[model samples]
Target: MTVTRDSITDFVRTLEDDISRVAICGTSYSDIGGVARVIEQQAIELRNGGYDIDIFTLEGTRKPPEDVSLHALGHFETSPYKEVDKLLTLASPSALNFVRSANRFDLIITHRFPFSTLGHMAKVIHNVPYVYWSHPSGSSDELFEGLAHAWARVQHHLETQNYAVRKADYLCAVSEESGEYIEAKTGREAVVVPNTITESRFGDVADEKKINEQFGLTPHDTIVLHVGRISPRKNIHRLIEAFQAATEGEAECKLLLVGEESMPEYSDRVRELADDDVVLTGFVDDKTLAGIYNRSNVYATCSLSEGWGLPLSEASYFDLEIVAFESIPAVNSLDGAYPVVNEDYDEFREKLCEKVNRD
Candidate 1:
C-alpha cells in the first residue's frame, strides 16, 4: 500500500483502539547482536501492553520472553551470492503459505530486508499495515568493503533497503542520525524510537564470584569491556592495539572482548592481535554479561558505526565509565560518555588509560 501523510495520521489516531495483534519479522533471534535484542524487547513490550505478539524469523536460537509466540522458519543453505539464501527462504512456498495461513496480524513490524520484503508482501496481500524498523542506513560501501561479492551485497542492500523504506506504511529509526540517513536516501521521514536499556536488569548486585570464576579475574583487576560482534566494522583490531598500548605495563588491567565472531577472517585477525591481557569471551548470556558489566571498570567501543549502540546504553545502566570516539552516533547521543576525537588513537589510548587507572 502507498502510504500518505493523511493515511499515516489517521492510522496513528486509531492505533490504540484498532491495533492489538502484532507480527515482528526479522532474520534471527540470537543471544547476541543489537537487532535481535531490539526485536525481543519490542515483543515483550507489546505483549505487556495486552497486544498479542508473534515473532517470525528464519532462526530463533534464543527463547523469547513470556507470552510472546515465536515461529522459526527452517534455515536454508548458504548461497554463494549476497543475501540469496535469505531471499530464497523468505520467498519460498512454505514461508508464503505460513504467512497466508497464519492468523491475521493487525500490524507487522519489520527489521532487515528481504525479511522486510516478506512483510511488504503481507501488506500487499492481506492489507495489514507494516512498519519498517530502520537499523543501519547510509551507504553500504563501508560495511561491505573487503568482503567477497562486495558489489553484489551493496547492490542488494540498495534495492532491498530502499524498497522497504519506500513501501512501509510507516518507518521507525533507532537513532536520529539513522533517521536523517533514511530521509536522505529515500526522502521518507522516520520517527526516532531510540533503543533503551532496562535499568532493573542492571539494578541488582553483580555476581562478582561468577565473574571471577568465569574469566579468572579477581576484584583487584581493572576490567575494560567491549560487548558487540567481533566484526571488522567493530574496529576490534584498533581497539586491541589501543588497549595494549594503554595498559602496556599495567598487568592488573584486562580487556574483555565479548560477543560471538560474526566474521571469521576478521575474528582471526583480532585473535592474532590479542595477547595474554586480552580475553575474547565469545557470546555470554545476559545474566553473565550483566555481571561482567558490573565488575568492569570501564566500557569501551571503537565501532566504526552503530544504529543506537545498545551495549553502550547497557554500560551506562551499570554506571561504568564509557570511552568511545566522538564520531560514533550512539556515543555522541550518550551522556556522561568520554568521547575522544575520531581516529585519534593516541588520544583514544590516553583517555582509555585514564579511565582504567581512575579509582
Candidate 2:
C-alpha cells in the first residue's frame, strides 16, 4: 500500500502497540548533519510521546537524556579504497549484533543509504518489518562533472541501496523530491515527514556578548551563518566566495561555519579561500547552535541539492532571512527564504548583501 503521512502515523501507532521496543539504526549520528539531527529529534519526540526508541549508530557519542538509550560501535575504515566506507558501514557487524542481542524488536527504522541495508538484513534474518528513511539518491553524482571514476562506485552503492529500498516494509522521505527519487528508483512510494523545529527549544539569544566574544565579533558585525557539513556537495566554497564579494573589505561583517568537515580535502580548499574573518567552529551543541542562529543576521547555503533544508527552516524560525539556490526544493517551502538562480554566485552575493542591508 502507498504510504501517506496519515498512514505512517497510523502505522507507527500500530507498531507502538504491537512492539515493546524499536531500534533506530544509522551509519553515523550526531547533532551535526541534517540526517543525524532529524533522527535524533525523532527519537526524542517519540520517547517524549511515550514510545520506546533506542538509537544504534555505527560511530558517535551517546549524549541523549537519561531515559533515552544510545548504542555506538566505533567507526571502521573500509579499505585502502575511498568511498567504499559507505558500503563497509552497511555491512557493520555492530548492527547485526544489536539486532541479535534483542533477539527481536517490534520494528526497525533505518536512515539514509547503506545503513538501511541493516534494516534489510534484519528482515531477512528475523522476519522483522523495517522502515527505511530515504535520503538523496546516489544518482545525485550524475549532476556533478569529473566524477566518472566515482560514478561507477556510486552506482554500485546505489544498486545496493535500491535493493534495500525494495526490501523495506515501509519507506519515508524527508522531502517530496526525495520521495519521488525513491519511487523512480525503487518503484515504491514513500511518506514525507519533513525535519522539524521545536519552538520551545529556542529562546532569546544567549548573551550576545558571550557569543560575539566566542566568535571574535563586535556589536556592529553582521553574521552570515552557514551550518552543516563542509563538503563539495554543500557548495560551501561558493558561499565563501559570495560572502567575500558581497562584503569585500568590510571589517564589520563576518561569516561563521558551524559544523564538522565531512571532506577534509574540501575543507582545506574552502579554508584556502577564506580570510581571517571566516570562523569555522567545527561543531557545536544544539544550545550553542540555537544561540548562533538567533545571533546571526541571515542564513545562507548554496548546496547543490538537499533532501530537506532543515537548517534554513531552523533559521526561518528565528526570523532570519534565507539565501539559497533556487533549485533547492526544501527551502522553497520555507517562509523568508530567498532563492537565487542555481550556481549564480553574482546573484547570490547580491542577495546576501541585500539581506544584510535590510537587516
How do the predictions measure up, each by TM-score?
A: 0.89, 0.87
Q: lDDT per model, in order?
A: 0.77, 0.75
Q: Cα-based RMSD of the predictions, in order? A: 4.0, 3.2
Model 2 clash count equals 0
Candidate No. with top lDDT:
1
Cα TM-score of candidate 1: 0.89
TM-score of 2: 0.87
lDDT of 1 by residue, 95-194 (tens): 8875685448888888886667777778888888888887774443554445444754654464335675588887877777777777666777777777
* Model 2 spans > 4 angstroms off: 1-11, 14-17, 78-83, 89-93, 101-103, 137-156, 159-161, 198-205
Model 1 clashing residue pairs (backbone): none
lDDT of 2 by residue, 1-359 (tens): 44456333444775546765778877677666677767777777777666678887776664764477888865557554444566666446775576566445778888765557767777888888888887674345543445434755574456435678787998788767777777777777777777676554565447678888888888998999998888767888888988888887677888999888866667898899999889998887666888899889999998867777788888988888899987776667888898898878888999998887766
Q: For candidate 2, what's the RMSD?
A: 3.2
Candidate 2 global lDDT: 0.75
